[model samples]
Target: MKLTVKEERCSGCNVCRVVCALHNAGAVQPSQALLKIKGEFPDPGTYKIAYCNQCGICADSCPEDAILERDGEYNIDYELCTQCLICIDSCPFDVMVVTESEYPAKCTGCGKCVELCPRQAVLADQG
Candidate 1:
């Protein structure tokens, strides 16, 4: 499973980001969410969403082999990670979230964001 975004339906609200942060970091900090919401430049009403497709790019980029794939879902193994921040810079989608105080994280296909999105903007695709 993977999370997909409907940019047209998004209201520029960041419930997805907040939920991601809570799941990944035990906080409400949207800045640490595994997904990214970007507002259109020079515009306030439009937004773009970037979410992990469970791609293994970060795992491949990890010099320490800390990023791992389990049952097709990818996540960082904190103990093996060295906080190199290389995954953050290597994400092709630019959605990888690696804060100084937190370990890197990726979507675990929990679908919390899809269940709670007020606009139904987040979808869980079984593909």
Candidate 2:
């Protein structure tokens, strides 16, 4: 399965970010989110949700073995992560954003972000 986000409908409200944090980390902050929202307002307002494609960049880049693969997906072990930002830099899509604590967070593929998205920008497909 893969996810596709609609950039046009995104209002950059950061709701997906918020929801991701809440669901994954049990927080309400966007910085804790795995997905990122980038774009400015009053100028075509193109907001894109930058997140993981289930790619293993972070997992392979991790030097401390903080990242791992499971069930055909990549996941971060928060306890093992040293916040090195290596995975963040390695990501081609720039989906992994740096958190306040310095660790990089990527989409967990929990589909929680999709459920909270008001615009239904995030899509899950099985093919």
Candidate 3:
């Protein structure tokens, strides 16, 4: 499944990011969330949503074989990850992120981001 965005429906409330971080990382930090909201203020239409589409590019690029696919969902195995940053470099959408602690972050298709979006801007589907 892929995470699709409807820019027009986004209200810049950041509820989706907040809930995503809380659900996946057990914190309220949006930066740790798998999906990110990017744009400039004073222009709501300019907002752009960036997220993983489960295309497997990150997994394929992992030199350490840390990234894997299961049931069409891609996930990073932290225990095997070598902090190579190969996945980050291969991500076409630039959605893969590596934190200061050296943890690679990407979407696991958990659907938390879709559930908490107030405007239903983010969707998880086969498309």
Root-mean-square deviation of each candidate, in angstroms?
2.1, 2.8, 2.1
Q: What is the per-residue lDDT of model 2 for residues 1-127, given as tens digits with 9 covering 90 to 100?
A: 3567777788777877778888876777666777777886668667756767887877888999888888768878989998878888888877777765666777778897777778887777553
Q: State the lDDT of candidate 1 residue by residue for 2-112, as single tens digits.
A: 777788898877888888788867897888887777888676668888888888998999999998888788878889998888898888998877665756766777788
Q: Give the TM-score of candidate 2.
A: 0.75
lDDT of 2: 0.77
Report how far residue 83 has shifted in candidate 2, in Å.
Answer: 5.3
How well does candidate 3 match the true structure in TM-score terms?
0.85
What's the ranking of the predictions by lDDT, best on top?
1, 3, 2
Q: lDDT tens digits, residues 1-127, model 3?
A: 5688888787778888788778777887887777778776776457788788888988889888888888888889999998888888899888776775878888878788788788888987755
Stretches of candidate 1 above 4 Å error? 41-45, 100-102
TM-scores of all candidate predictions against the true structure: 0.85, 0.75, 0.85
